[model samples]
Target: MRSSPDPALSASSNAMLARARTTFDIEAAAVLGLKQRIGASFVQAVQKILEVRGRVVVMGMGKSGHVGRKIAATLASTGTPAMFVHPAEASHGDLGMIKPVDLVLAISNSGEVDELTVILPVVKRQGVPLIAITGRVDSTLAHHADIVLDSGVEKEACPLNLAPTASTTAQMAMGDALAVALLDARGFGTEDFARSHPGGALGRKLLTHVGDVMRSGDAVPRVVSGASFSELMREMSSKGLGATAVVDREGRAIGIFTDGDLRRQIETGADLRALTAADVMHVGPRTLRADALAAEAAELMEQHRITSVLVIDAAGVLIGALSINDLMRAKVI
Candidate 1:
């Protein structure tokens, strides 16, 4: 049996929900506030990044450092070469990583972080362009930067107004804006992004081709046009494709025979012993080019309500065969 609900516990849950809603409101407002300040400085930052010959060196301290690392990764994957370098480590020997050809994207809410501020002059001395994402536009970091993106928030989402909640969100949003702008400027397309992420789902979908996943050579089940009913059945069963392609003398697919056709013929009480591959096969079977994307093959199967398709060359000769199971195995589906 279910026990009665506790009144005190219910009240506590209500209070927690109210506080969570307040946090969401405050953080959302913080990100929206950034829109008003995006103008010349933001464009300048993008222009500088596009003009640079080397990778973007991102740096920050504390919570800002975490945001910076994510920003660096976003920029890198989106076609802008970038890497994160912790400000605290830069003072020791990591400063050497910032060459004259590189650009620095520094993130700090207060614009006065000790670890980050200490290395500004060294970065400037090396002639590396610096773009600052900070709350305080009049602070030292802004003064030293070649371009300053204002990511200031009105207040922290924390009740104590001390934790870097809303401030960090604003910084991350600003970083995303920069990465998107750079991606557009470089004309980075889906194929380019897929090349960088070859192991991901989008990469698999875009990079995988019919030629890569289709069964080639003897693995494809085939029978000549004049082949007997037994030959067609044996070819389909041995290859386990549930179907057999009836090819002409020059290896071009003329028709296809499947188990469905056999079932229908059996239901009609037709003579199966005297039939050849050409007599029972379905004419004008759907075929795809070998170089077409595997995704196209899956679409063809789904649209025509068929489980398999034959791959062909420029001359329409049977080159390979693909099945829905083949697409599933390659993770293209």
Candidate 2:
């Protein structure tokens, strides 16, 4: 039997849901507000990073430092070289990591964080280009920066308005905006991104080729055209490819025989024992070049509604075979 809900619990849940919705509203508005403030300073920051011969040195403190680290990673992965350095650590020997050729991107909500501000004069003395993302345009960090990006928010989503809620959201949005602008200006593409993230899904899809995933040599299931139906079945079962290729004397694929063809022949009541591979196989089978992308092989399989295809060379000689199962194992599909 079901029990009735407690009124006290119900009221508390309602209040919590309302607060959650309000937080989303506040954070969303903070991010949206950044769209209007993007102008000259933003463009200048992008241009400067593009012209730099060295990496972007990102620095911040507290919550802003967390956001800065993410920003640096995004920048690095997207083609712009970047790394994060903690502000407090910078005062104690870490500042040496910032070279004159490297540009500094400093993040602070109030722009007056002492750990961050204390390094401003030393950074300026070294003649390193500095870009500031902060709420206060009139603060000391902004005054010393070569470019200032306004990440100011109306208020925090925190009930006391003391925590870094909406403010941090605004800072991250600004960082993403800068990364995106710089990526476009540098003409960075998917292949470049994949190279930086080879362990990721897009990397596997773009960098993997048919040769990398196809079964080659003895592993491929194949039989001479004159071979008996029993020989074809044996090759198919041993290789576990669900199909077998019929090849000629020169080792070129002449036809293909699949489980489907066997079922069709049985349905027709044909004398299976009297058949040769050439007599039962389907001619004009689908084929792919070994150098072609695995993604292309997948598309070909999908287009023709087949579970496997033959891999051939420039001379159309059969060298390998690929199947849907192979693509699955490689995570190309």
Candidate 3:
């Protein structure tokens, strides 16, 4: 149609795309440049959060609400207890969620959501801490908050420059910075993360110990030093574990034999009928402490290039066996 419009004539149509790209690059650079903008007010905000006896109540309108939700989730997952409240909903009975000792985190591009502004007096009257994220340092919300985090952006991604795209991105990045800062300040550790996410895969990997997954005592597929090959086979088959531990007279693990060992012995033409547990067992197969973390055991198995491990207690007495399957079942994989 119309001579199929020349490909070179796509300039005006592509001008908006260039502007959008430039806007995004500038926004990303602005986020990276935030390190220089942070000051003592950031520390004061953290102190306000730490001292608050109640939950962090985050309120925003429209697009700001979306960012607030993410910020609340990040804060909650990292040790600080926070929840999002819609400014509109807060006016209607939902305000009850805001306790007197709570701290309010209000987010707005203009720093003037009518709903949030209306509730400002209430927050202040309760003696609650108020922190604001806004594009203008002297905006109403900023003036009201005890600490104001500037999230200004030079331009918008919209071609008309009317949308709040880059400004919102800058705000979201600042919220993440605050969350991580508080996480470090609170001394949030892996153990604390595990406690928060006990049912998740990472939690099981970090907190499930060798003792938690190991088959213990009689189920360890162990035999004494003098047990014959026939006795070893019976013990291995009954226990259903791939490997059997070899122990001394004192009932401590001395060595181990597995399906691999059986294959090697068969290849070597060793007489299975005459061999004893001590004669054929591979000495000192990979062993683990009962108290070792399941992730540590997994790492050890990977490091030593093995599948199964023997679990021994503090006294070095054979207590149990842990197989790769046990780790998978515990979600340590």
lDDT of 1 at 290: 86
**Model 2: residue 95 alpha-carbon error in angstroms:** 1.5
**Residue-wise lDDT of candidate 2 within 99-157, one digit each (tens)?**
99999999998999999999999999998999999999999999999999999999999
Q: Over the full model, what C-alpha lDDT does candidate 1 score relative to the true structure?
A: 0.93
Model 1 C-alpha RMSD vs. true structure (Å) is: 3.6
Error of 1 at 138 (Å): 1.3
Q: What is the total number of backbone clashes in candidate 2?
A: 0
- lDDT by residue (tens digit), candidate 3, 42-139: 88888889888888988888888899999999899999999999998888988888888899999998988799899888888878889998888888
Q: How many residue pairs clash in each candidate?
A: 0, 0, 0
Per-residue lDDT over 1-333 for candidate 1, one digit per residue giving the tens place of the 0 to 100 score: 323445667877867777877889999899999988799989989999999999999999999999999999999999999999998889999998888999999999999999999999989988999999999999899999999999999999999999999999999999999999999999999999999999999999899999999999999999999999989999999999889899999999989998899898899897888999999999999999988999899989999999999998988899889999999999998
After TM-score superposition, the amount by which residue 305's alpha carbon in candidate 3 deviates from its true location, in angstroms, is 1.4
Pull out the clashing pairs in model 2.
none
Top candidate, metric lDDT: 2
Candidate 2: Cα lDDT at 189:
97
Ten residues in sequence with the least summed lDDT for candidate 3: 1-10
What lDDT score goes with residue 125 in model 2? 96
